[model samples]
Target chain A: MRWKHSDYTGWGRVHRASGELARPERAAALSELTKDETAPAIGMRRSYGDACLNDNGRAIDMSRLDRVLEFDPDSGVIHVEAGAQIGHLLKTFAPKSWLPPVLPGTGFATVGGCIAMDVHGKNHHGAGSFGQHVTEITLVTPKGEQIVTPKKHPELFKATIGGLGQTGPILSARFPLLKAKGDVMVVTERRVADWESFIGLLDTSEATYSVGWIDATARGAALGRGILEEAETGGGLVKPAKRGKKIPLNAPGFALAPPVVRAFNATYWRRVPDRGRTSVKPIDDFFFPLDKIHDWNKLYGKNGFHQFQCVVPLSSVDALRAILEKIANSGLASPLAVLKRMGPGRGGYMSFPMEGYTLAVDFPNKARAEQVIRELENMTVAADGRVYLAKDALASAANIRAMYPEHDKWLSAVTKADPDRAYETDLTRRLKLRDPA
Target chain B: MTPTWIILGATSTIARAFARLVAERGENLLLAGRDMAELNRTAADCINHGAPSAEAIAFDARDMASFAPILDKATATEGAINVAVFVGSMPTQDEIDGDPALIAGTITDSFTGPAQFLTLLAPLMEDRGKGAVVGVGSVAGDRGRLGNYVYGASKAGFHTYLSGLRNRLGRSGVHVVTVKPGTVDTAMTWGMDGLPFLAQPDKIASDIMRAVDKKKNVIYTPFIWWPVMTVIKSIPEAIFKKLKI
Candidate 1:
């Protein structure tokens, strides 16, 4: 394997890493590369932080190794390479009435990334996290390749999930796919007046997939006002998606400034009538709404942005409201803010999901915004909640350990799997996740 | 009838992408390469994508024995049998300068070996009177200069061989496309500096598919390379030899 000197950044582009990267195009190559080299494996770099980074070190780029190895149409179980993107699976199988059981906000997230993050989807209330559906995984460590299943090696399975690629490099995985009604989605968009109504709507939503888009710029009476979009798989013929659009270049800093964001949010909120509206869309349009515009992160400008996502218990909804209120007052939030209800479903020791409400908001990387995110992290911990590691670019090490009580277990498992600290990434080191509690 | 594609040097990134494209179109694939493990993975990937049948066969440009299995695999399938040649070797100019013996291996891997194999397979394609052969040559072959003239000469030989094959095959209703690609982002040019018009492997793969569909005899990928190479070729030998590009 040839190592290329590459400077890479995560999706948010907030943090950067310069390293030597070896991109293996096949599983055999990956196995051979891992046998001697000690490096973390990264997929797509969809995580908004350094979880995918290794500064001044060696790392493996797993994107080229993406491939679907096997699929059972009847059983709806597919075995895919770790680098395979979930979007590819949806595009291939949605027409066949099967889809990944869980999908993150972006279709570009690789299967390996989804596993490493143990990502949840809009249907977290129904399907749990991505790893819950994974039947088995082939993890390639410096020692050798080990195939672990949920039943065969539950502890290692749990550790590898949301383990941030520390357990080992994931080679391939077998996971059950969900049965879709059709290739299109019947989506209902309703306007929520405030935080109460948004939470009420989410709490009462019966749809298989539900998510709320919050107008983080709104304050006082209008605080938390946004649209609740609920969707269900429906059958019908629609024109296939047009060629995806590109963002072209990074916008100026003023593009997502307070006034522009407020105006955009107001117009976006009124897109649906007070009486509510329903429409049919291709599955991708509803699931990965931002994906139509490729590299939308460039909208945040060159410095990049930070996404602060946290989940608080159901009883702590009021604390969550206070956090949103703080964000509203700051006037630093961007147009992309989301709120969702999660069931008590998780697959890993360090998994982020809980039986609570999860709020995700983006802010342009600036001093005030960084301060607000730190304060928000404090409030989240006070509410006995945890933040999503995939979207966090800023969080103190102590705060992270306090948030994830099972961190020690995950740490022990990772240490055992990679005793030489072969797979430590920027996030793990920053959070002191590899060190004993 | 389903079209069957035989891919040479299937372990390369561009060849893998090309095989996947043909696989997605519901064609059959026979991946020929030196590494069986890598080839098998790609074959499985193609099969899973949509290929009616996908199999991996051993192939080594330096070994004559490896060529017959590929030919047999192509003949085993019915209907139009398309073949794409993505075989070549590029040892750095400095390495070649140090070891003169490297020249023969380079010629065999890039020009003579594939030319010989295709010469044997040409009769079968003629008898069938259908199919296409995509011979991937490089824009470096346009003119031998300071950087990598040894590899350039080998590709130049392959280009001439492809032109003659195209002339011969056109009479039998078989198409031959000689694809001259600029610096593509592959293992070969992974960390190379000063690469102009660097193209992705998938983009090159799609370009080859489009060229084959259009039955174009000779084309340059990214399209810009045609003009760029034209200008480079037009430079006078007196000055071109002095300036290192």
Candidate 2:
């Protein structure tokens, strides 16, 4: 067994075992790693934090192994290597004007990694999570690495989905894809004043395929409440542009000030009419616009950035209000804050989806900013919600433990899967995603 | 006469690109990470990009005691650690699952180990009269999150250490830059979700280098994160302990 860890952060930032790192494209890379007494599936480096690192044990970077093994246009089902990134797959289907029912903000993430996190998206209010769309997962378990699907091993299946790679290495996944209405999305952005209005807006809309918000300036009344957006692609009304037409590469890390982002938000809002019509085109504009840029993440500049996302119930809308007020009153205007209404959810131990509204905020590394985040986490917990671990860069173990009460069960399950604790990554070690299963 | 940079965590997707970016502008470099073989591979890659002499060093961020030896060997040729950057750490994503001590160890390795290493190297730079040490700190240190407080605390301590060092060493000719990269696409937040403006490591590394050169004390990768964080911090605990984000 061999290990190699590489991320999109850059080639030099990646880690690899000189002795290992087989071209997974030739064969299943994760299979080689799982062969080790302890190994976990490796996906593309789109994860926001350290949940994928297997450390010295073994890591199977799935990037090279990425391939669409099979796709059923009729049933909207596809099976791909655990390493296949969403973007690669999108290219294959979006041209035919089809897309994954649910997707994370980052398109570079792998399907297997998405399921492991049970990723939720802007359309979560209408769609459940990534796990909901997943019909089966081909996993490499300690029990001789069998192909376990929801029907085959329901317990392991549920555990594996949103299991944080603790249950086993997912070799491949089967999911139901959706036909894109068109390649473009008809999105409308409406500004909100407070959490109540944001929640109220969600109650009214959000069934429109996609939903999001930007907590810009995080200012007074509009603190947590910023820009509320709802979008849906046209029903095949517009055609997608050429797939091969490459978008220009990303520019350097210039600062995104409140004025700039706020202007962007304002312009975006202006461009978007006030909920007068229903229309759409090009999934790129709607689903993963920034993805078109090679190094889009650079907008944050070099100091880098951290993204914190969490889900809280509609019942806790008041708590949401508190978050917004605090941010605004803090005088630390956020450039972006998003709000979304969610639908029925599938419960996974480490998954971030639940019945309610999810809010995602991006803050630069400011000493005072962290204080606001701590306060936000406490409020989210009090509201009976948990922080999204995948997007989190700085969550505390105690908070994670408390938020995910089933954490112990997940740990025990991981322990049982590999008693020697052979499979351990930086993420597992950090979040204690190490299930003592 | 371009300055050559060698990063131990080179080949870390971000680090590799960063090395190349710097080297491309005529800076010579030696990129190194876990894979010594891959380290050389990245070095050769930089050479292709315009780095006159990009190379690799086999060093580990986890081992505290061994850093000095590695630095000793490294400085033997380089003379001093000019722009030393570290992005390697056992990033904790899961909650404390099994042993408390084990979790502590992760924090110790991620935080204390780096802190101690910096402590060891600080004087060296001060004596030499010019150097920079940049670290990636997390917003998790602000207070504590319901999801990852321990890791956050460790970063907090690390940030503090950098702060203290920055204050003390500024006059001594050694510049300590603490970079608070928000959410980045590294191996750190695997399986986590709903990232807004999540950063990429290469950009982060580049940003850190720019900040180091510009002599910025603390940098929030994305500047907006700064004001955003300020608002989050100003939240009074009375209400802070209760609201959900």
Candidate 3:
């Protein structure tokens, strides 16, 4: 394929970037692609922002680099191709009690890219992020190929985990797999008519999985009414896994706006609560309800859509409420707004977590939508929580570093390993993120 | 088997350029065609050019059923076809002068065969979720001109199929690209009467590869054609029916 350094994945509202599109089949190919280039690597083209973009450089399409090399069912660890999709692994190995340690919603994403992006999920509040589960990564460093784990290269490991592909082109990874109890979960649905109910639910059960919210203005007189779904992987086989094999089909374009989503969310919430507090959901329903539609992202339409996800400290839940009220007051067609909780930030220098609240809102990113987001980001900073790098469409680099606090140490490790700055990506270039040294 | 790309149409100037482009980057190159010697020579040339791995797998994209076994065997030897580029095709306009039966057969070979192979082969890429299928089309398909309209129609149909596949396979992480070259200088266009501008196969291949990387749905090789074809395709038949474009 043509090696282009391009980045148009996120923000048609923003400037689209570019990258190198080199295909690497094996180790030698991987090394060659990673050869002292000023570009970084790109996978599955899912990043909503410039993370996958490296200006005037290159991006090795690691999707083809996938190869499930080995598996230890007992140990629940897998040696796989850097470009392998998590969904594929779940189908083939998850049944046998093996899965990628970290899985993002874009199941088609490459494992290596996931680690590079350090994706997190609903369970992120509990498990931190995908990188947290990564035991080791095979790096095609400019120096040479080295199998680096935490112990092998502690500094580089941390940096690479959240370094956003600046450290090196991740060739493959050896990750610990979890024994999946089918793609099923025990979910409890509760309607939060206002901010109080929302916080009340959060204070109660510390579920392994959680997420939900509604733009009450979109829901008519039900200001701030929303459903909060909490799911837990309770031990024990529930039912035989349907193990659906049908590939996701394309869906018709249906806009989920404040009005439409509020109606749907209201209906959905009513059904859930009526059915009782406890219910069973397919893993897809619980984890990635949107994954079923192949190009569901396009539903946002030609202008494209952007999700602004940020974590706000517990003390700042009031700030989040103020922000929601502000968004509601604006009277824009916001169909989707999510609220979740974050725990401790283990070590990701740019980690977006705190013992606080996280809110992710999906907006059709038209022109000037960024300005609105920046206003919210200002509020987040004021609240002492930060925007998630993974889902952020726009967050100033200074803001990111300021929020994470470990920015300096993170860059030190990156600069040390990638001395030539040969691994800059769109995300790095956009925020002007660089080695502090 | 660690995964290798076995290009079936290695002799076409377009195919050769793609091989050279990929080989230049240090990947394993395996060329296959009717001309075994040319295939081998190209394989050696690819290796010399710096491909990390290179080999020749003799097969044809025209013969549909035979391809599965050959592809299965080759991927068995090398891993799987991460990106398969179909650059082999019969000359355009030949269908105009040729018999209807012959035209249908050629069209099947050119269109249905590749489509079948793609549908069959898609499962593997889906299993992998990272495979991409790049098919070469022509801007002639933008509108049915007097010169190469039949061929253009087939390309258009093929592109439509590609759109469906792209949509169907996106979640599986596989991508399909439709490369519509505005005009290209390949053996098929050697002595054609009048042509204003024609892109070099290598240059066009370069554009095709980039579109593939970007996972773009449809790409105009030179980028200029993006607008040119838009205007051309948008031309009203009522106004244009009076005069040829």
Candidate 4:
């Protein structure tokens, strides 16, 4: 395999990596490359932070290795190469009434990336994180190909899931697809008046899939005001999703200025009526709304952006509100913000979900925004919450360690799996995750 | 009756993509390749994608002995038995220069092997009176460049052979499409630098299917290669040899 020198970035585009990348298209080629020299495996680079970046080193690009190796219709189990995209899986199986149990905000994320990040979805409160659904994982370690499952090698399995690809390059995975009513989603959108009501609505929601779109720019009586979307899969026919449009160039910086954002948010909030509205949408439309606009990250312009995401306990709702208040006062928050409830279902030690409320807001890559995110990270730690590593680009290692109490266990497991640290990436180094210190 | 596409070198990136395309249309597939494991996986994938029936058969391009069984299996299904040949090899010119013995294998893989298999299958296509044959040749066949003249010469010979095959097959109502694709972003060109206007394997596959539907005999994929190759082919041999691309 020839290694091509490439300059790549995370979804945020705030962090960049110049590295040599080898994209192997077959399973034998992947094993052969890993046997000779191990490197971090990256798929799609959908992480908003540097979790996928390996600067000044060789990395394996697994995109072309994507394929469905096997599928058992009776059991709904699928064996796929790690590079298979979650969206592609849904497209293939959804029509047949089988769907991936957990889908992140974007369908572009590969199965390997979902496993590495332990991503959650709109149905996270019910289906849990992506790793929780996986039955088996084939990893290429220093010794050779090792198969790890929840039953066979539980510790290594937990460490590999949401393990940030530190344990080894994942070769393939086996997971069961959830039976769906159909390929379409019946969605209900209701406007939340304020913070208290929004929290109450989320707490009482019985929908299979629920998420809140918060207008971070709102203040006072309108604080936390947004649209609450609840959805459930149903048997129906809908038009095929339109062809995705690409963002050809970086948008001007002024395009998302505070005044412009406030105006946009106001328009968006008013788009949903007070009485609420019900619509039938393509599964991808409801699951990955912004994906229709390809490279939507470029909307933040050349400087890129950072997404500050953290989940606080059920009791820490007040603390979460205070953090939101601080963000609103700072006037640096973008219109793109989400609030969701998570269940106490997580597969890995480093997994990000808990039984609590999670808030995620995007901020332009400004010095002031960095300072605000640092303050938010501290507040999250104080509230016994943890920042999501997938979306975090500015959190300090000390703060991250404080958030994930199982850090030592994860570190020990990773060390045992990769003693030579050949799989380290920019995120691992930045967080000092491999260091006992 | 549903058509059955016998894809030679089915493990190849382009052939795999073409298999999926035809499979989605509910066609039957005979994925013929040397790698049984990989070909079986692709066969299963094609089935999942919507093929009525898909099977993997062993095929070694250089071994003419492995060719007849694939034809016999396709003939068992009473319908239009189409074929798409994606078998070829290109050892870098530097490697070829170091080991001159590689030329024979290159010629067998890129030209003589598939040509012989198709020669054996042509009469069967004539008996059926309806089928499509897609021959994947590279633009390198248009003019031998300094970088890979030997590999180019093999494809050039295959292209000429295909032209004659088309003439004979046209009389029996069978269509032939000679596809000249530019650099495609497959395993073959994955990390190759300075590849111009590289197309995706899926795009080339779709283009080939469209050409079959339209019965276009010779076409350049991505269309841009047509004008580009035109310029190169028109250049006098003296200047072309002197100017390195």
Q: Score the docking of each candidate (DockQ).
A: 0.66, 0.01, 0.03, 0.65
Spell out the clash pairs found in candidate 4: none
Best by DockQ: 1
TM-score of chain A of each: 0.99, 0.85, 0.87, 0.99
Give model 4's TM-score versus the native structure.
0.97
Local distance difference test scores for all models: 0.92, 0.65, 0.67, 0.93
Best of the candidates, lDDT: 4
Question: Which parts of model 3 have CA positions greater than 4 angstroms off?
Answer: A1-7, A11-14, A18-20, A36-38, A216-223, A234-262, A275-277, A345-347, A435-437, B1-245
- After TM-score superposition, the amount by which residue A282's alpha carbon in candidate 4 deviates from its true location, in angstroms, is 1.1
Return the lDDT, model 2, position A215.
53
- Residues A1-437 of candidate 3: C-alpha lDDT, one tens digit per residue: 23533345653224365544565434565675455453567777777776776555656767645445556657877777677777767655544444455566657777866777677767767777777888888888666788888887888888888677877777778777777665567788876777777777776758877776665354334556678888865444556445424424322335555567556665765765544488776555566565565566666666666777777777888898877776666555355677777666444555445677777777666656667778888888887878877667678877776787778888888878777777776667667778462
Candidate 3's displacement at residue B185, Å, is 22
Docking class of 4: medium
Could you tell which candidate, 1 or 4, scores higher by lDDT? 4
Tens-place lDDT digits, model 1, residues A211-282: 999999999999999999999999999887885899999998789978888899999999899899999999
Decoy 2 TM-score against native: 0.58
For candidate 1, list the clashing residue pairs, or say none: none
True-contact fraction in model 1 equals: 0.61
Q: Candidate 2's error at A184, in angstroms?
A: 4.0
How good is the docking of model 2, by CAPRI class? incorrect
What TM-score between 0 and 1 does chain B of candidate 3 receive?
0.88
Q: For model 3, what is the error of residue A1's alpha carbon versus the real structure, in angstroms, after optimal superposition?
A: 7.8
